[model samples]
Structure formats: C-alpha cells, structure tokens
Target: MFVRSLNNESQLLRKIAEGDQHAFKIIYDYHRRAVYARAIFLLKSEVLAEEVLQEVMLKLWQSAGKLTDETNLGAYLTTLTRNRSFQILRRRVLEAKTEIELRKDWTESHNETEEGILLADTQKILADGIALLPPQQKMVYELCRVDGLKYEQAAQCMNLSVETVKSYMKLALRSLRSYMKSHTDLAVILIILKII
Candidate 1:
C-alpha cells in the first residue's frame, strides 16, 4: 500500500511538472490544509497564515517545472511551507520586540506629563522624515523596519533584485540619519539610532 501511494505521488508530480492543471489541483487539495496548519502554528496569526499559504502555493506553481521527482514531493512541499512559515513568524516576532523596546524607551525616559507629548511629537517628526525619503528608499526601509522583513524577503515582495534592495536600504539609512541629525534632539536621536 505504501509503495502504491508512492508511485501515485510520483505520477502526479510528473504530470504537474508537465503543466497538468488536474495534477496540480490534486497536489493542492491534498496538501493545502496541512500547509495552512503549518503556517498558523508558526505564525500564530490567521491573516499571516493565509498569506503564507498563498505564497507557498504560488512558489510551488512557479517552481513546478524544476521539481525533480515524485519520491521527494512530500518532503519538498513540507519543508518549503515550514521554512516560509518560520520566516514570517520570525519577522513578526522581531517587529513586536522592536515595538516593545521603543515603547519602553519612550516611557522610561520621560515623566508622565511630558512623556506622552514627547512620544507624539517624535512620531510626527519621524513620519515627516519618512515622507521626505525617496519612494524606493522609503519602501525598503519601511518593509524592513516596520514590517520586519529581511532584505532578501523585502526584495522578493517588492519584485526588485536583492542587490537593489540592499542599495535602497543603505541609501534609506543615510537619508534617515541625515534627516534626523538635522532635525531631532538628543533623546529622539538615541531612540532612532536604537530602532535602526
């Protein structure tokens, strides 16, 4: 029975690689819930899980032409979903940590009367500074810092080359640093530096 199942998977994969929609549909139907569960387990967010599911299946379709054989189909798909789920989970965690640290700094550094005001002021100034950045630089920086995307992942999301993403990030940091240096006070400067 196990050998028969293996053979069936192999045949399905071959047809999938040859661009058979029914074969692809079978794979999708067989694996979609497992993939969703994997993403949800790692990401802990339904929205993120759904997004990961779409992303993983899209990647499977795109790479179907390169899939080598049926013997590895289950392993390959499982690994791919797991990896992508972990990646998204890690990014969310990093973003949450950064947000917590930023809030902690804001709270500890200022007394009650001034702390809220200072934080609000700084947030506005930072928003304005971000607005001044060039479109590509702003995008790269926001995706990395706010969305917690790594450079390579942001590049993929933006459909830009990785090298281009790196370049945009460098320029974005330079621009942000220059803007902050020109406009911010010492405490806000420290916070911005820490966040970056």
Candidate 2:
C-alpha cells in the first residue's frame, strides 16, 4: 500500500514538473492541511503558519522539476515546513535580543553627557569602517544589513548571485569587526552592530 502511494505521488510530481497546473493543485489539495498543521505546531502562530504554508507550497511548485521518483513527498514537505518554522523562530529570537540590548544601552546612556560623546565617537568609527569597505562589499552590507533587505532581494537589487551577496556580506562583516576591534573602545556597540 505504501509503495502504491509513493508511485502515485511520483506520477503526480512528474506531471507537475511538466507544468501541469491540475496536478499541482491536486498535490496541493492533498498536502495543504498537513503542511499548515505542522507549521502551526512549530510556529504557534496562525498567521505565520499560513505564510509558511504558502511559501512551502510555492517552493514545491517551483522546484517540482527537481523531484525524483524516490522522493517521499510527505516527508519532504514536513522537513521543509519544520526548517522554515525554525528559521522564523530563530530570527524572532535574534530580533528580541537585539531590541533588549538596544533598550539597555539607551537606558544606560539616557542622561550621561559622556555617553552622548561616546555614541558620537562610535558612530564616527562605524562610518569610517563602512567607508573603508570594498565597493561591492559595502553595497552588499548596506543593502542587506543597514537597509534590512533579504539576501535574495539584495542580490536582485545588485544584479549579483545570492551566493556572491552572501560572500560579500561575510567579508564586509569581518572587515567591520576588525576595524572596530582595532580602533574603538566601544565593545557594546560592536556587539549591537554585529547583530545587524
């Protein structure tokens, strides 16, 4: 019975690969609830789970050509949903941590004139570090980190490959860290910048 089910899925996948919208819809109807349930279980938010479901299904449709006869469709969808949910959770945690750190810094510096001077100095150092980056790296860092763009969006904006954007971002971060370590006494600022 299991083998028969796998065979049926393989047939549907092949049809989907061939651009059969009907086959895609059939598979979507079959799996949408399962995907949504898994996403909700993992993410604990209905809105986010729905978004994940849409994203996962879109990816499935786009990558259908890569599916093979040996693929277990249910397992594949489950894994994708789980991974994406975890990614969102991780991002939310990081954002919360960054916000808390920022709030702590703001509270500490609320009334200290010296803190204002230090912040100005840190900004100058950061500006200098940004100025020193290679042009491509600077663009990537600014787009993805400063402007809050996703890697894919940055790649599109720059007409570069996603991997290249990622590489440039990595290099840019290393350069900034090195510059900060060498020239600044602002360790907390460095940690905050690193989060960005």
Candidate 3:
C-alpha cells in the first residue's frame, strides 16, 4: 500500500512539474490536511498555520521542477512546514521582545499621558522624516524597520543587493535623524530613536 501511494505521488509530482493543474489539485487535496495539521500543531495559531499552509504549497508549486523521484513527498512537506512554522515563531518572539523592551523604556520614564504625548510627537516627526526620504531609501526603511523584515528579505523583495538595502537603511536613518532634529526637540528625537 505504501509502495502504491509512493508511485502515485511520483506521478502527480511529474504532472505538477509539467503544470498540470488537475494533478496539482489532486495532490493538494491529498496532502493539504497533513500539511495543515503539522503547521497548526507547531504554530498553535490557526491563522498563522493557514498562512504557513499557503506559503508551503506555493513553494511546493514553484519548486516542483526540483522534486526528484527519490524525494519523499511526506518528509519533504513535513520539513518545509516545520521550518516555516519555526521561522514565523522566531519572528514573533523577536517582535514581542522588541515591544517589551520599548514599553519598558517608555514606562520607566513617564506617566501614561506623557508617554502617549511623546509617542505621538515622535511618530509625527518620524513620519515626516520618512516622507522626505528618497524612494529606495523609503522602501528600505519600511521593509527593514517598519515591517521588521531582515535585510536579506528586504533585498529579495526589492530585487536589490543586500549591501544596497543596508546602505539605504543607513542613509534613511541619517536623513530621518536630521529631519527629526530640525522638527522637534532632542527628547522627541531620542524617543523616535528608541522605537527605531
């Protein structure tokens, strides 16, 4: 029975690589439950698991040409799903840690009203500064800083070199700092810097 299933998967993979939607659908239907189960088990968030399901399947379809006869479909999918889930988990942890640190800094200094006023002023100045950045620099800032994407990921998204992304981020920071300094007091600039 396992042999039969392996042969079936191989044939479907071949058809999928050849861009046969019917065969791809067949395989998706056959394997999606297992993939979703693995994702949900690891992620423990249905929405995030659903996102992983989409990402893994999209990667599968895009890399179908690389699927060899020796590839164990079940193991390959499980590994992919697991890796994606862990990637998301790591990002979440990083974001949460950053948020906690920022809140700690904020709470240590002022009351809630003061914190809110300072945050708003800092955000406005930062927004104005970002608006002044050049196009590539703005994109780099948004991707790397605001979106919390890694430089490599932002480079891939922008189709630029990683070095270029880093350079843009640096320049963007300098420009934002100069702009913020011109617009607000040192304290406001420092608040924005903490968030950045």
Which candidate gets the maximum lDDT versus the true structure?
3
lDDT of 2 by residue, 86-137 (tens): 9999999999999999887774434478666776777778789999999999
By TM-score, is 1 or 2 better?
A: 1
Provide the global lDDT of candidate 3 against the true structure. 0.83
As for TM-score, the candidate ahead, 2 or 3, is 3
TM-score of each: 0.61, 0.53, 0.59
Candidate 2 clash figure, as a count? 0
Model 3, position 4, has a per-residue lDDT of 21
Q: Which structure is stronger by TM-score: 1 or 3?
A: 1
Pairs clashing within candidate 2: none
Pairs with backbone N, CA or C atoms under 3 Å apart (clashes), candidate 3: none
Better by lDDT, candidate 3 or 2: 3
